[model samples]
Target: MAAVAILLLVWQGVSVAGLVPRYMLPAPVEVLQAFWKDRGALWNNSLITLQEAGLGLVCGVSLGFLFALVMDASPLLYRAFYPILVITQTIPTVAIAPLLVLWFGYEMTPKVILIVLVTFFPVTVGLLDGFRSVDRDAVGLLRSMGASKKQIFWYLKAPSALPQFFSGLRIAAAYSVVGAVISEWLGGFGGLGVYMTRVKSAFAFEKMFAVIFLISAVSLLLMALVNGLERLAMPYRKVKQEEREDSQ
Candidate 1:
């Protein structure tokens, strides 16, 4: 917060002192005023983007989870598919967006697809790593105790994967909004990106800044929600932290 305050103060000083033109880099207060003025429009557009992001995120996570399960279940399948996954990510999203728009016709489907493509890799990789990282000795012990594969998975693998899954989820949460905005830029009836395009065309730089800040806020909010979910999903983390504090 202090760092952000300092950066804002410097930005204000530069803008107010005419070191940078206001049109090129508006003062923070001017951006705030723009945001306030367009609050209603911004809210409406934001909801549209949020809906796209949320749907993409849910679908992307589910898809990645299923892929992770399949790959973890079969080493041959992992070998066959892992390279394909990495190859898909190698294609730049911007390059793909226009094609998606062309095929899907400027609707929400392309945007959702773009976001899923952007967000799923981290989740798939994180979960694969976690599932592979489980202790061999522990697995052997569980097997010695006559544990079923399902029992070993639930008791060991699933719990082990939660940390990495949430780590990937945090990244995915941020990426989801960004993906939605980028896809919106290609073509969309409504969204922060569409609003930005309009304001930019009209030379409303302050409003542009306002929308930029709003996109960032939305991304942060998504990440915070993911963090909250992580806490709920792993209450044992809190218990461990409390025990460490008590020992200290």
Candidate 2:
């Protein structure tokens, strides 16, 4: 918090000192004022973006998890799909967004697709890595105990993979909103990205600054949400009292 305060103080000092033109980089106060004034539109647009992101994230994570299962179950599947998945990311997101909008029209479909595209890779890779990282000895022990493949997966693999899954979720959470907004940038009726495009065209620097800050805040909030979900999902991952004492 102090660091943020100090940075803001330095920013205000720079603006007050006229080190840069206000039009180019508005003062934080100006941005704040603009944010407050535009709160209604921002709130409405934010809702649309948030919805797109939320839906996309669910779809992305689900698909990625399933893909991980398939790949982890078969080495041939992994060899074939892994390279293709990595290759998909080589195509720039900006390039893909326009095509998705063109194909899907200006509705929410394209925005959600963009989000899925942005989010899925991390999750798929993370879960796959997690599944593969399981100790071979543990699997052997489970097999010796006459555990079925399904039983082993349910009791061992999934649980062991959860930490990495959550880590991927954190990354996906950050990407989801940004992806939705960027999709909106190319074509959308309303969203933060649309608002930003209009503000930039009109040379509303203060408002642009305000929206940028809002976007960052939204991304951070999403990440915090993912972190909370991680705790809930991995409740057995308790911190030992001895570790706590050591830290203290």
Candidate 3:
């Protein structure tokens, strides 16, 4: 918070001192005023963007988890599909977004697909790494005790892999909103990106700044929500923290 304050002060100083044109980089207060002025439109567009992001995140996470599980269960499948996943990542979001918009029209479908594409890789890779990181001795012990594969996964693998899953989720959460906005840039009836395009065309830099800040705030909010979910899902982490504090 202190760092942000300092940065804001610097920005204010720069604006006041005329280091840059007001049209190019408006003062924070000006941006705030713009944000307040356009609150109604901003709010409506925000809801659209949020819905797209949320839908994409859920689908992306599910698909990634399923892929990770299948790959983890079969070494050959992992070897075959891992490269293909990597290749997918090489296709830039901006490059494919146009095609998606062209094919899907200016609907929400393309936007959601873009978000899913952007978010899927991190989750799949993170969970796969987590699954593979399980202790060999522990797996052997479980098997020696006549544990079923399902039992081993439930008792050992799932818990062990949760941290990695959440780590990936944190990244995906951030990507979800960004992907939505980027997709909106190409074609969308409504969204922050659409609003931004309108403001930019009119040379309303202050309003553009306002939407940019809102986009960032939305991304941070999503990431924080993911962090909250991680805490709830991994109560043992809290216990570990408490134990460490007690030790100290």
| Candidate 2 pairs with clashing backbones | none
The alpha-carbon root-mean-square deviation between model 2 and the true structure, to one decimal in Å, is 1.3
Instruction: Estimate, for each residue in 148-232, the C-alpha lDDT of model 2 and write its tens digit.
Output: 9999999889989998998999999999999988999999999999999999999999999999999999999999998898878
Q: Can you tell me which runs of candidate 1 are displaced by over 4 Å?
A: 245-248
Which digits, one per residue and each the tens of the lDDT, describe model 1 over residues 100-212?
99999888999999999978889999999999999999999999999999999999999999999999999999999999999998898999889988999999999999999
Winner by lDDT between candidate 3 and candidate 2: 3
The Cα local distance difference test for each model comes to 0.95, 0.92, 0.94
The alpha-carbon lDDT assigned to residue 187 of candidate 1 equals: 91
lDDT, candidate 2, equals 0.92
State the lDDT at 19 in candidate 2.
100
Q: RMSD for each model, in Å, please?
A: 1.1, 1.3, 1.1
- Model 3, range 1-248, lDDT digits (tens) per residue? 99999999999999999999999999998999999999999999999999999999999998899999999999999999999999988999989999999999999999999998889889999999899889999999999999999999999999889999999999999999999999998888999989988999999999999999999999999999999999999999999999999999
Quote model 1's TM-score.
0.97
